[model samples]
Target: MDHRSETGHVMFLSPERVFYAGLLGRPRNRSTGSLLIYVGLGGRLMLTCGGRTQADLAIALIPPFVEHTIASDARSSLCFTVEPESVTPAALDLLARRAADQGPALAERICAAYVRLREGGCGPGFTTEELDTIVLGAPLARRRLDLRIAEAVARLNDFSGPAATAADCAAAARLSQSRFLHLFKQQTGTSFRAFRAHKRARHLLHFVNEDLNFAHLAQDIGYPDSTHFCHSIRRFYGLKPGAIFSGSRDLRIYRGAAQAEATAVAALA
Candidate 1:
């Protein structure tokens, strides 16, 4: 697994897997496929998952089935995502609440304890008691609607392109549109449309930087036309696609010309 920033990285852990830890750079729409316990050591990062915003100076204990996209500041950060299935749901819920409350000190302690367990520093039977202590000390109990909204936002990472409307998302959550909107704002502190747009923009930026196949990238990401695509690029980044790729002069369009060139190169190679 390449954890390097420019090349994007992904790791998969089976249900039995436990205590996976590492240092990560600014991650874009990278799926963990399990619960993630991220500790931000240096600069702040903006993490959009499950319709929630996990931003600056915060430690995140993400739940399973959640999708996360992270953008780091100038400094790099250390993050760990552990599969929490081995622990009781009560413990997991407690940790999630602590992270939501931005309890970095408590998060750090938990991480340290986890690392010790992974490294054989602690005996086999110690985990249950330790987790209980941590959970008891941490703040717990948040609204269920808030957690559901966060789960919805996290689901976006599974999407390869553009996102469904708030109504669409609300329906998926089995809630009315109005109720979903209210809960989404209350939980994540941002609107559903805004969250979707941010996720799309991040995906677009990744495609741009990676020089991915433009047309497919556009369609994969949910834009009907180059005009709409370009408009979105401008709206989010404040720069036209042309301006973004102006000097370098690769294919100006994301679809036809660029795809043709890439196809030809692949055939020849």
Candidate 2:
């Protein structure tokens, strides 16, 4: 039975990862602050960047916040989003090697791991460690995010009911606006504005499979209107909210992380 048909609920995959697996339409261009690894199950996955077809891949790794398009005949895929600040040098090296290799060993490992999860129908949420092991060829020590930047990112993720400004993050991070702006980019590998926007846009995941009013959900996620919401989300996820909703009618979402555990414990209480 479809879980969404009953409650349209959301579940955690891990603290740093959340994904929807099921039928999905071809994605439009999008980018995000986390590394995106995808496996096109049941069909070929094509990745395009800079107006050229970069890879016709079954499994692939895309670095954080890089613009790209996904085209596939596959009805379903597994998308893993790892917080970039937590990415290891080894992992980065592996991603780079895999990105340049047509038949990288890393891709095969990632594909195999994703197949297991996909065959399990999106349950058994994966740990960030498992994701690391699959893509990096070994478990690498998690790189720590800059404390100030991490605080700011957490503040942004804490609440979507209100809009947060760059100044707010700068203040929360306890840095001069100018310094915060510079350091944020240097630390997070994305601009402050884009990072906040992507974080807000990422929250849009919780409601993707819901039948709520787009305009209302837009505001709930701090977008000024439906247009901005659609555009911003597409800018990151490469698909519009409506298109995603339609395609993921029976979608299975799994979230992961320490955050997910806390949410579970709270619910039980």
C-alpha TM-scores of all predictions: 0.38, 0.80
The digit string of per-residue lDDT tens for model 2 on 12-56 reads 355466543455466677778777767665576888877878456
lDDT score of residue 220 within candidate 2:
76
| Residue 138 in model 1: lDDT | 34
Model number with the top TM-score: 2
TM-score of 1: 0.38
Model 2, position 236, has a per-residue lDDT of 79
Which pairs clash inside model 2?
12-255, 13-254, 13-255, 13-256, 14-255, 14-256, 14-257, 15-256, 15-257
Model 2: residues with Cα > 4 Å off, grouped in runs: 3-15, 102-104, 118-126, 134-137, 159-161, 261-269
lDDT of 1 by residue, 1-269 (tens): 32232221211121122232333433545453345666554456577877777667456555654556766563434444433323446656766676677566755675565444334443332332333343234322322435567567655533332467787778888999999988886765556666565555444532432555566666777677777777776655345665544422221111222233433554576
